[model samples]
Target: MSGSFRGEVRKLLLHPYPKRARDQNPSREGFPIRPPLNNEPRTADEEFASDTLRRMNEVLARIQELEDALDDPSQIWPRLRGAWKRAEDEADPRMSEIVRQAREISPVLKDLEKRIRRVLRRTRELTPLDRVQEMDRASMLWLSRQPGRTIAERAGPAQRILSTVRYENFDTLENRVFHSYVRLAALVAREWQREHRQAHGSDRFRLVDTLRLRCRAIACDLEALGVGLAEPGTTPNYVLMQDRGYRTVRQNWVRLLRRERILDDLWAWQAQTWTDFAVLAIVLAIDELDEARPIAQSPIVWRQEAFKGRWFDQDRPLAVFWLEETGRIVEVQARPEQPGPLLTLARAHVSLRVTDPTRTELPRRIAVWTPHAMQRMDIQVGGEDAASRLSEIGQVASGEIMRDGLILTPAQGDPQHLVASRGKAHVDVIALDASGVSLALGMEALREFIRRDIWR
Candidate 1:
């Protein structure tokens, strides 16, 4: 969860670049070595070359992931093979040309073997998951070190263009060329990125366009990380900068490329900390907008009528929904103990019932509790027995609602408002937050649970 070997492999097709050195590659047209010329149209050969390049890149990424996984040979090799096969199936004539040049770095097998052995050895010497946690903490520290900026600081014409093109899907020749460059830049940037694990820029691959490329890479990386977790065995145990020796190798690679006048902005950013949170925040906000509903009014606060004590709940969605539905009336308990920004909402007195994301209207129930509102409880979908069962599972006590007042916080602001409230006795309060939906047990699931006697 902490490190990024998982990210490295999964992101090759989408981002191919490091977060800091995107768009940093020198123009292919102006390279000291003449760019290859194909007088013929994009034939099978050209397509095959492109496919090979992509495949090799993917194989390299798999090697990185396998190394990070410490060659959990039972699991990782099959994955690597799958990656290779996928890349090969996608290959065309252009991919073949790309394959010819790929050996310039190293044969795929040899390079992969080297990277794998290196990563395996490093994993043997260090605890990957712990280091990943450390790296996560480090990334947080890096983000905190920078002053948080508004979206306006970074949003400009480029964003507008990209947004437009994102919707349009770049069909023009110029756009296609640009897309190719972006893809190539991404892979090159990863080379630089693999070196400097810090979140800043590097010196080895500085084009005027580098920052945007890096941002693209990071965005792509995060996106891939999210997708990889959706599948099993794709998530690796290690973070990006887990090994000091790997860091040294990255540094040396940059130093070697320094004479080529690349990697400056990227390396600098790597050594110095900076935050693209303005960009990331915007994207995250956009993502949330698609998933959450806005609560319109604040609910009445109530005393602890249903539940007695305030305690912690790890179900983020459940906790978030509880607060939005019920305002502060009970002796609300606490806040997150970590050192980043804080979010405060009300507590859940009743259980919230809902269906699962993987299944439509498949009923389930979850107990919700928060720091600000204690008496209110929310459930997903279940009966009293199911609620009791889930409550016991969550380790929170059932509470009584003593009084009611509008004292809760919305995700966007500090105003205390009850986003949702149900008048029915069977359903106490249902609130939907950015994280999860809080509601009562649906009748269907309740009947099923009763018929099956599901609760133990």
Candidate 2:
């Protein structure tokens, strides 16, 4: 995320990149109609959340607008009804409060509890007895021996006597519930941690980290209280289920489990399409549009997918960033599905819709990104022949090139793959590592070209 997913998908596009059109079979006697399918998910068993493009964007926005609630409980428990749902509606806070407690407050409480428990409060009583070390010296009974007294006690000395002792007592219901809740919290935190994928730089990671700390605190507090698993809470633990805050904790735990289940289903459904290429494309586009802000923030829908349980739109973008600079309303889109004539070769295209009443010309493709291989597989191609090699590959994929336009590709050693265009450019080829190209610089290059004839 620090890199803004920049050059990230290159891992996905590793090995030799495919032909732009998914055609172009090597010269053998056989002629093939279609290329082998490259439609597998980048990961075999897991799914990426950000891969859920456009759909979640609008839903989150709409929900925020309609409900006017930052954290909508209805989304968590849609069937929630009655005053129970409306509990403390003034603050409308029970659900969020519990989650927040688990997030930030629980951790501190647990830490304090653990530190306190290391030297827990104890009261002197005639119980929790240890070895008999001293006798009640003021009592005459110590001078007299009982009939069953041994010879050592009667003759040698009063060897031992029972006395009051002070020690920690942990057999309370409070201790049992503390242990139970801590373990439960740990389980929930693990799920959230996995969901975050431990990408610490991300906001998700920070939230998950806070929750993890809370879980640890709970465990330590229980451990300090000496709560063991062998102990049973045969009766209902009122401390965990009673009162306002305690009750909210239970509710939050259940809701979190439900959310995880739904997310699991969504992860399964993400296999329908390969949205990574375009997703990364959009990420780079935004990096270039750094100064410009989106017209409106995109909102999310809890469960919005083709199927009932899934989480996102497999084909549409995650969020559409529309930037209005001067008279231009630039809408950047990364259409992987609509890869023009280049089927899907880890390719991308950048075009513009400008309103100029004074100008009259068909909107031609401005910049064509035919990256045969994006990852820096061939560092060998960057010498005196780099330009010629680039031209040849580009021509093969998309016939002819705009002498004054841009064609960005992979050249790992070539900073941003910003290579100068030269002649024929026709019937030649190129293979640029388009992973880390400066999208803004490339776009500007096309706009401020020296030649007016190549007006794409």
Candidate 3:
């Protein structure tokens, strides 16, 4: 239920990057970043690394059910993966090479962009200063109290300077930061231009070209403003630590890189082909059932085993929720057909059915809930009636499952329209929302108790 419509479309690059909780997604070229709370929003044309691809995939998946009527749906990511597989089978290598080439240079581009930003911010906050040795009137007056005098200040001020003036001077970059900044910008600009040139299409890596031009423009702008590109100092810049603005921005910049944790809240949906409305229906059913209090006023009990295998590995999926409603215990699991450890607390803890992602049909993705008895013996853990339930478990090594015609999934059409006339029959249609489907399941599951003769 957790991983539904699990598509086999992970496009890996030559270099492996960590898929951490907050992924930078440096591989996705031209992916528009949905802003994190700590970061500034992206400009419409500017491209930077973020979870744009993942969010786009999520949005496309959500709208797949709505647009199911459309034929030849090749634009979505899941569909694209299928298309890629077909191409691979046909021995077509050009498309894959062209697309993945961008991934190779993206990490470099991202790091370059971050460095440029850091240098620019530090340059602004450092605010270059100059030391001017001068003998101004104010300096002379102050010097008169220095107990010097004795013709210390003669005409034309024969000495070097009466005093040295240490003041904030943006007038000349030959002083500290700006001149070195322009040189740094120019160095990065040349490298960026080289990277842009290596990229094939005119439009493909235009963002890199844009960044390259920006770097060049920064150097040109500073030179135009009467600042020479003087030699850079290798000395450590402790001034940045003192600047509150720089300190705050640096902290936020780090946080901004890692803050946006959710990939589902798409700013706007895009294309992808992954269908799992059945999974949603099952999950929604679980939520609906959990919220309702049983008529018998019995509390729900839950049990689970930790998952410790790699992705797509043969792992056990089990979560037991005991509902004592109408004197019955229901256990829910993704793998209900397989032989597993027995349920212990009481008898007949029914589990809602779930299956592997390879099964594309709705019935295979999920099954209607049936209040049947669980397996016995090695499958039976404990309980007073364990002896009786074992005999009913059949001569099978695995468990058994069934369906009761309950509204486990919602009908098609608007939820508002479906609400008024939903009481008529055991209706079936393509559902538009999960909430309506969930409500239907909650009510219908309760009704199944009285309709069945086994409990009587």
TM-score of each: 0.16, 0.35, 0.27
**Candidate with maximal TM-score:** 2
lDDT of 1 by residue, 1-456 (tens): 011221232111111122232344431221111112222226655454333223223222322332323235334324433333332221111111122223232232233223322111111111222133222444444434544364232333332111101122213222222223334434544443332233234232233125335435533543442311111112222321344432332333333333123222222231111011111111122123223232221221221111111111222221121112222111111222321111111123222233333434323332233212111232332223233333333332222221111111112111111222222112222221111111011212222322222121
Those runs of model 3 whose alpha carbons end farther than 4 Å from true positions after fitting are: 1-163, 168-253, 260-284, 287-319, 323-328, 334-351, 354-399, 402-456
Worst 10 residues of 2 by lDDT: 30-39
lDDT of 2: 0.36
| Ranked by lDDT, top first | 2, 3, 1
Q: Which is the winner by lDDT between candidate 2 and candidate 3?
A: 2
How do the candidates rank by TM-score, highest first?
2, 3, 1
lDDT of each: 0.25, 0.36, 0.30
- State the displacement of the C-alpha of residue 37, model 1, in Å, after optimal TM-score superposition: 28
Model 2 agreement with the true structure over 305-398: per-residue lDDT tens digits: 2343223332333333344442223333333334333212223333322222243532223333433221333322332243444344355434
TM-score of model 1 (CA atoms):
0.16
lDDT by residue (16-55, candidate 3, tens digit) is 2223334454543333444332233266432232333322
Better of 1 and 2 by TM-score: 2
